[model samples]
Target: MVIFLAETAQVLAQTPQSLKPAPDAEAGAQAYADNCARCHGPTGAGDGRDSKRMHPRPRKLSEGVFKFRTTASGTPPTDEDLYETISNGLPGSRMPDFQRLPEDVRWQLVYHVKSLSAAFQDKPEPLAFGKDPGKGANLAKGKELYTQLGCNACHGPQGRGNGPSAATLVDQWGDHIDAANLTQGWSYRSGSSPRDVLVRLMTGLDGTPMPSYAEAVKPEEVWDLAYYVHSIQAEPRWSSKVAAVREELGWDKAPRTDLRLSSTFYRNGEIVPSSVRAVSVQAMYNEKEILFRLTWHDRSESRETPSDAAAVVLLEDPNSRWRSGSLRGWTGKTEPAELLSYEDGEWTALLKRPLPSGKRAGLGVMVWDGGNAEQGRHRSNSNWMELILK
Candidate 1:
């Protein structure tokens, strides 16, 4: 029989005093039975009746391995993290948002979820995520540590996930796991903020090949490496809001391309339409910033709700093999241009970023039309297009 005593205690211990009434395990069990058991199994083994049919499959709660967390990878997530996941659900997966549930009920579910794994019996204390090293965030030091720490063995020299050991990696369940392509922060399973990356480095993903660096490097050095990771991020083009500046830069007559886009492959090997078949791109740059005007046709405008959207991705390596293939896994590491869009049957967006000192930049584009229920991993994308800097 699974006991909730320890798990409940853990929750109470971690929760802030203001957010209390300490979660009731009995209540949590009922809530779990009513909602989660259908997909998570009665015992949380991930063998529920619906589990086998789902692509990527439901997570095995008993193993206590989580992909989205604010804590160190191997460490049990805080009660708050669990509450957030329960409330928001995992994007791109079958997990449904439970924001409609009462707050206490959600907290109850957090407790019950913890009870599923004995791994929670002796929870590790949270790590202190110190401040960034400021001026001490040295890229050179970080680059050196990246090599000395053997990160290149798996993450590759360019942080492209093409290292020699990358091909043979697998997770605890023996499912293949890719070495993180460090260039793309938007796709990070746990958020891509600087603090997020720092937590990952210190805690390491518990059940995967990624290990924690808590013992390997000093906290200050970790900050250095974190900043180093930040340094290689693809820079965006920033343009002045002045209309005359835009015209002087020839933004009015920028070259355009109507490129075809297709659905990214689903885990089950299904190919779906991006709802949008084509996209138009017009790009221009001023002395201080760069701008891209994108136009795509769609029947409905989905701005108010979590619906249709688009993105401009810039690659760190122009020669990457993923230049023309699917954008599924590539979005995580690439730098994304900030975008603002307007819609009236046809959607128009102005993507802008700061200009870097380089003569050329690798660029990619993607569109999401929510009318077809497209979001997350489901969308249309283009291969790399080299943007020559003037």
Candidate 2:
């Protein structure tokens, strides 16, 4: 399978590229507020109240953003470029990794910090983080490296904002957009130039889902990602947080239930009306057909309210990326069924149909929080997957 090759040969065989630069300001700002503000000023102007105690004083963020960064010469860093800095902070700087947060968030912060000033415009290309990323020499190699890195699952082919599972993501905003459109020359959140983009990627956005990828993806791979993302640039359909997860969590282990359809959906975890599950389900799938029996359980140590209003369920291969598709159902049975559970946190989807071929498959579950919103907030969780094969 593709995974085996990626794990053994690709990971090592591919030569590492220097940090590719591509940053996201929307994500970076969120990361800054979450971690950096403890010392550096909120706007990065060095006026943060906490900065008063620092011995050397926090660097004036607004005065000049570059001097401290690792850039590509007169140009600013790219998103991938900033990810390196966020994951591994400057040795002499007070910045540290709250890697405890998701990986993309740190990258977002890198984008955020880069947006602090427009200095990136006249900036020259940055020196390679360690070695220079070959100029236009690694596009094919990088594209191969991207899928090998599992980025294809989220970013989609050609970086065209059309990933297999991008349509169902629902965020705190209750709006859905594909992944960030890479082809656009303009930053969806910030940065008038590419360098600003890199910094935000290095720093993660605060109070959001984007995370720094310093630990998992190599620096050269990041550069490759930026290059490919640029290759497919165009009008963006997805912005900072609007995502569809129908692809990630839509898989079935056994076809014992029926499914209608699944889409990437989001919700306000905290504001999910008392008994409601932030993102809930109405039924299960049985062998590609829609079934009604479905249930959910909170089997973790995390604190959570009991769900009664709604629950969530996985629709296997709903997008047809896999061999089979799934059926989906909602409680209200209407276009806008109440998917979120209210008080009863657990529900089991009793399938009307039994296993046909009796095969088990892998699954994906909700893995994000909604964050601060009106009367609601996103919480964190580590939902796992089930198995089925025939």
lDDT of candidates 1 onward, in order = 0.64, 0.39
Work out the TM-score per prediction: 0.57, 0.27
What does candidate 1's lDDT look like per residue over 300-325, in tens digits?
Answer: 45554456677776654555645435
Off by over 4 Å in 2: 1-137, 170-178, 192-201, 204-206, 234-390
Error of 2 at 28 (Å): 22
Stretch of 10 with least lDDT, candidate 2: 1-10
Off by over 4 Å in 1: 1-14, 33-35, 49-56, 67-75, 87-100, 235-390
Supply the global lDDT for candidate 2.
0.39
lDDT of 2 by residue, 104-210 (tens): 57656756766776765565343333233546436676678667765555455554334555445443334442344343333233331233334334443322233
- The true-versus-predicted C-alpha distance at residue 342 of model 1, in Å, is 35
Clashes of 1: 12
